[model samples]
Structures are given as structure tokens and as C-alpha cells.
Target: MTQARITIDRDFTVAEVPRRLFGSFVEHMGRCVYSGIYEPGHPEADARGLRQDVLKLVREMGPTVVRYPGGNFVSGYNWEDGVGPVEDRPVRIDGAWHTIETNAFGLHEFVEWSKEAEVEVMEAINLGTRGVDEARALVEYANHPGGTYWSDLRRKNGAATGTQQDPFGIKLWCLGNELDGPWQIGHKTADEYGRLAQESAKAMKLVDDSIELVAVGSSSRQMPTFGTWEHTVLSHTYEEVDYISMHAYYQEHDGDAASFLAEGVDMDAFIDGVIATIDAVKAAGKHSNQVNISFDEWNVWYQRGLDGEDQPHNVAKAGWREAPRVIEDTYSVTDAVVVGSLLHSLLRHGDRVTIANQAQLVNVIAPIRSEAGGPAWRQASFWPFARMSALAKGQIMQLAVDSGKTPTAKFGDVDAVDATATWDEQTGRLALFLANRSMEEGAEVSVDLRGLSASGVRSAEVLTIPEGGDRNSANVLDAQDTVGLKTLQEVGIEDGVLHVKLPALSWSVLELDVERA
Candidate 1:
């Protein structure tokens, strides 16, 4: 196999990227909520039952906004069940995962956790099985500052301190979660969901106009209602809603790393398709507001099926008496590469894609892993996300890379290298994240810094494992340590081109601290 080369030109610039595009999601599914963030008696837990260790790690991830309450779990969930006293909370069957949901962690708990983690909440209301009234009630409860029944109920539930105590100051909201899939509890057709979403959004806005609403788009690019769903939903609610939500998950069940790496190529097209649909809605001439996208749910999940029939839901629940960690997929090196590519794609399209979340936060296909009563450790996926979240501030610079192609089962021959660049003008630092998806050969990359003249490269870090498909095999209880970034020597400018070597099947971040010209 021949080596590929990537060139990043600093002259190309997109709009001033919104910082909220790098947001994350935390659902109430599996251990993501129960044991993941809200375990009360864990050695590291606090007075509010949130694990402080986990909170510290999440704060480091630098999530600007977090979507809450559900993925598929929201369709069947009643937000009212999770509030009030723990003894009054009901144990309901979670139809999405076929497990019992002990309503121990609810709306108030998530708000508290968001506060502790120092992130804003992107709340979602139940639209499937429930209607506009419940949705409006949730908004009034969270956003309204007293003078009403719901706000008074919140005060009674212990959120009363000051004017700022209202967690409903939440800026973003999703109308519902995945109402198009057959797996959804009250799955509706395009017309049904679009109309319901419009009404819900209208009512929600009446309660709080400052809050932005995201209409439910297709669950995936391959869904039966892919283009039709977005077109219809936007046609109905485009005027009332601020953005549309999209969800997708990457899986390599055939165990083809090459094919898995190529999945991101589809993600690129999927995002473009969504953007086209958004433009189509604008052309329809019903509204003046531009609808952005919230890729609220995404990540690689497909580990449990390989381990057997998911341990029989009820039996698995019985195994751990309290807050059992479930649906956790220990990430692999390949997963890290895909994640890097996804992040790059989000940055590249930062103009319209406002918010992006990496599925779950902990225990459930997340970057951080936690044991029920044991220590929490950063998974392999954590390094790239944390580094990007920390350094991916300021303006996003559009990068042009020319590279060779690698064929896959899903996507035909595709580029082996994908990358994005960010310039922190204040700090005088250029951050470049690159992923070389070649299974056989490395990338001989060239950096063409156009607008900003740099004297020399400051530092380079590459995150890779010895084996191509290496995974984190250590159980949650064990001390888990996987491969991470290793720093490289600075690159000197030669003929206005700064060159660096990117390893095959590797994810790298290059930080160039330049002297201002």
C-alpha cells in the first residue's frame, strides 16, 4: 500500500464556529444515569448522590451543553415519575432497553448533576405516548421562576434559593427522541410527529421564547424515513423550532476495521443531506428563521451482542442489587479513530451543525467508565474527546487535505486521512486533529499555513496502540490503562511547508505555537 499525504491550508476559513457544537448527551438509559452519574453510596459520591470523581472527569471533557432524559427511553418515560420523593418514585419498565428503571434519578437530579459538572442542560420532553400538556408542564416547571403550580412544585422539591435557582433557564430543548423508529414506544408517522412537534414547540415557546427547540429528524441515515422525515418535520415545525435533531450509531459487527473506518464517510454525506433538507425547508417559504442541526446522539455501540444475549434483562438487574453498570461498550483503538473522524466532520461543518453529543457520558458506550462501587477510569475514547474539547476553542479553520483511498464494504474507495484545524488567535496556537485510517501504510502529511506565518512547530502528540484493533479488555474494577498520545519533536518550516509523519491507524493532535508576524 502507498503512503498518503494531507495538506492543511490556513487561508480557507468557515464562519466563527459556535462553541456549543462540541456538546455531549447523557441519557437515562442503562447505567448512564443510575450508576454512571447518580450513585449515592459510592465512596466518591457527594451529598446529592452524584459521584465527585466522575464529575471531575466530565468537567474535564468540557461539555458546553448536555442533552438529557432519554434516547429511546424518553418515548416511554414520564418525567413526573422521576421527581418528588424517592419513596414516591415509581419503578417503570423501560420499553427501549427491556429493563426496569428505578426512578431514583429524575429531572431535578440531572439539573443538579449538570450544575456540579458545570455544564448547561439541553432538556428533552416526552412527546411519544404523551402530548402538548405534559411537554408544556415540563417547560414551565424547569424554566418558569415561580408564580405558577409547576414552579411552586419545584420550590417545594427543594430548588428554592435565589432567582438563579431555576434550572429551566436551559437554553436548548429537543421535542422528542427518535419517534420515527419502530423500536420507539409510540412510534409515529412523519405527519403525526411533525404536527405534534409543531404544537409542542409552539406551547414550549409560549412558556419561554428564549429556549431553542429541536424537531425530531430521522433516527439514522438508513432509516425508512430518512429524507422524508426531515422534509415533513421541518415543513411542519420549521418556523417554531430552532434546530432539528439527528441520531446515529456506528457498529462493526462483521469485525471489519476497514469498513468501520469508512462509516464516517457516510456520516459526512448524512450531515450534508440533513443540511440540504434544512435548505429545502427554507425554500418552501413558510418561515424566515434558519434551522440548524443538533446531532444529539452518536457513537460506536455493538459490544454486548458479542458477549451473549445481554445477560437476560431481569437476571442482569438482579445480579447487582443497586445501580448495576450496564450497556457499557469498552472502546477499541478503531473506535477511537472513528471518533476522531466524527469530531473532525463536526468541526468542518460547524456553520450549521450547532450541537453534537457523543451518545452517553459514562458506563454506557461513553468516554468514561465507572464501577458500581469501584474506581472510575478514562476509556480510550476519553483522551481524544478531552484533548479536542480542551483545545478546540476559538475559530475553526477549514482544511483541505489530499490523500489516497481505502475501499470498504459500506463506502467504496475513500480517503485514508481526515482532519480539521482550529486557530486560537488569542493564544497564538494552531491545533490540528488528524486521523489516518489506512490499515497498511502511514501518512506523509504536509501543513501549508497560509494566513498565519509560523516560525516553527511547537509540539505534536499521536495516540495509537500497537495492535490495530486493540481494545480495553480490563473490567471496570481493574486498573484500566490503554494507549494514549505520545509527544513528538517540533517541526521546522521548510519552503513554507511544515511536514510531519502520521502513523497508520493512528489519531493525532498537533499543536503549533507560532510567533505573531
Candidate 2:
């Protein structure tokens, strides 16, 4: 077994854990909308037609913020089409996903669902085909409290009646979604997008100055215009926008599991690169208001195996199918480990990357899976995310690790054991999230808690493939325990030292209370 040591001190903290960091996405594509979150006649559905089973799981997962409407779907979406009465709504073709949009679920419906799920809505506007006027109008209709044109219209539409929280109360808004990609409906050059975003942001804030705006960065770090796109866009909209968006998807390719396991290395680099770009622009422009990263879209999507090299653009060639199954990649145990590592990367950078949403909430590469009219179940990726969301709180503690290095095809030399620590000073609780990246051997981790007046462990859990189980094992509706997190009974804390054995290619969470001297 490989051995490693981790040292954490309460005085050395990165930042307070941003509550918005535990966020999820819900786009109007695939089964994510129709049979996913809303199924009017499902046996488990509530009065609002939202799946009660799914809502229960979502609540258990504890996402603080939820981004609404569109991955690519928002680029050409018309906000007016999805408001007012559902019977009066229009049925149009979603050109981005090549799917027919019934417009049954819109802004009002989303707000209703978000209330049930107990999550704040992060709204995204359509800058792909529409612009400043429409964006500003949306803010007026959703936020303003009566007496005006749009707000009065909202009252007439019955959206403000019988609710303590009237006018939607949405604060975070996205200027556009992936506008730099050529595949977008009204894709534009960096200069063009920057000007449009700036104007739209200015107009929207005029209607409601309390709202925070996010400008599009790059669709992916691999984009040809990655750094340049950020620089140019920030040059124009830096003063108007509060955050820049980031979207990324990772997958194991061609039997290269080793490199794929170290996905955090790539994620760290991507975030650092964007930070450098933002700093460069800030220095050049000498702006006062600070800009942070809103990583609104991220997940482990099996893009390569989906169709072809053009998988993301593989919209329904069979013509407009409503709620058709698309890119529903079944996650494995290995994928869950990589996801845990990715979460570590995000938490490690909590100082700047304030808001992050794990792509889609259900049926579209999400942690929770639901079958239409069938039962809902947890996927392999669900355990790590759920545990991290519930256990991690307060401030992120800085961890220094001394470990053996492993050479990979990519990322060169990476530590065999990667871990992150969280210290909640208010509750006197400390949690450690650890990942063992080795494919063949277990890791013995020695945690130094000397600086802390620590008590006994509250709980310790680990997720991995069982003795007879394959790494590809995943949970189904009936067999929910196939690849789930189980308690680690062998962990011990002796003389301020934590000793635990991490199974190969697994993720673990260890928690305990601390008392200050």
C-alpha cells in the first residue's frame, strides 16, 4: 500500500465555504424537463406535477442554487413564450437541440419548482438570438413589484398571488450561454458578444440594480478562442458583470483510465488560467469592482461514446421529438471518484470560484436518475456529492500533503492521494474529503490534527466497488445499494493522528468535532 500524510491547521484557511457552490443545473433539453422534473400524471408527482421522489432526493442532496432553462437551449429561447397561462403558451422548435419545445415549463413554473426544492433560481437570458430589450424586460417582469407595465402584467398573469415571496425574488442572472461557440444560434465574435453583453447588463441593472450578472467565458478550455475571448469580453463588460461563466465536461477515453482519474489536475489548470486572464484584464483596465468565476456548467459526460466527434451537436436528426432521451450517460464507480476529485478542486479554489452548478439535475448526466413513470434512484456519482454538500461547511482549511507521486500519460506527476479539509468553527466540526487515485493499490493516510483540539469521529464513509463487484457497477431503481457509500468501521484517531485506509480508486469522507484551546 502507498502511504501519505496530510497536515491541516485552522489558522490556514482559503475562504469560507460559499453556500452557492453547492448548486445544480436544469436545462430545457432531453428528459430533464418533460418526464424528468415534471410529469403531471406520475404516481409520485405532487400537485405542481413535479416528481415527489425526485424532489425528496434533491432535498437530500442539498443544492443551494439551481440554474434554470437552457444549456444550449437558452441561446434561441424567447422568455415571453414561457410566461402567463400554459394554454396560451406557444409550441416552437428548439433549433439548438433540434427538439420541439412545448413551452409548458417557463419562468413561473421554474420558480414554483425551485420553491418546492428549496433552492434559489439562477436565471439565464437569451442573448444568442435576442438582446438588451428582452433581457431588460425579463428583469422588469420577474422582479419589479407592480405599478409598472411588466410587473402589472405579472400580477394579471396570477404569478404574484397567494405567495409570501412575490415577484420571483431571483437575484443571479446569466447574460448568455456559450455565445462564443459557432454552434450557437446567433454566435458572434468576442467583440460582438462583449458589446451585446455589456449593453444587456446595463439595461437589466437599470430595471433592477440588485441583480448580479454573469458574462460568458469560453464554452470549454479547449476552445480556440479561450484566453483571447475572455480578455476581449472582459474588456467591454468587466465593469457591468459581476462574474464570468465557465463550462467543462470530462470523460475517460480509449482505455486511458489513469489519466482520466487525475482530472482535477486539468480542472485546477483551467481555473488558474482563467484567473490569470481575469487579473491581466483587471490590471490593464484598472477596474475597481472585483470579478469572480461562476462555473455554472460542469460534469463527467461520456461525449466520445455518445455518437461521433460531433456528439454535442448531434441534435435529433430524426426531427422534432419532445423529451427524447439524449446523452444520458450512466455513471460508474470510477466516474464518481473523478467527480469527487473535481469537487475537491472546486472547494480548494473557494476563494475565487464562488458559484458552481453541476450541469443537469436529473436524467441528463446528473447525479440523480429518474425513469418516466418509474422509480427514482441514486447514481454512483450521487454519494460523493451528497456527502460533500452536507458535511462541508464554514471555511476551507489548507492541506499540505506529503505523498508518493504517480506518473501518468497526461498531467505528468500527481500525488497518489488527493484530499481537502473543511473546518466549521461555529459547530466545532472538521471534515476531510479524500480520494485514492491508484488503480492497483490501497493508500494508508496519516492525518495530523495536532493543531486542533479534536474529539472523537462523528462518522466515516467510503464509496467503492465491492469485493465481487466490477468498477462499472451502478445503482438502479430496484438495486439501490449496488454502488453506494458504506461506513468505514476501521478508522481510528490516536493521539491527534487520523489513520484510515482508502480503497483503490475510491472516495472517502471522514468527519469529527474539535474544541478550541
Leading candidate by TM-score:
2
Off by over 4 Å in 1: 1-7, 159-167, 303-307, 311-325, 467-479, 515-517
lDDT of candidate 1 over 1-517, digit per residue (tens): 4345545455567756677876788887667777688788999998778999899989887888888887877888899888887777888877666677888788888887888888889888888899899988988888899989998887777533222345457778889889998868889999999999999999988988988998999999989879999999888998899889888888875667788887778788999999999998899876678999999988887755545444334434354333344567777677788888888888888898888988888887888888778888887778778888878866788777777787787787888888888887788888888888886887777777766777667678877764433442322346366466677543456876677777777788887775434
lDDT of 2 at 287: 88
Per-residue C-alpha lDDT of model 2 across residues 234-285, encoded as one tens digit per residue: 9999999999999999999898888999999999999999999999999999
Poorest stretch of ten by lDDT in candidate 2: 157-166
TM-score for predicted model 2 compared with the true structure: 0.97
lDDT for model 1 comes to: 0.79
Model 1 C-alpha RMSD vs. true structure (Å) is 2.8
Worst 10 residues of 1 by lDDT: 467-476
Whole-model lDDT per candidate: 0.79, 0.89
Candidate 2 wrongly placed segments (more than 4 Å): 159-165, 305-312
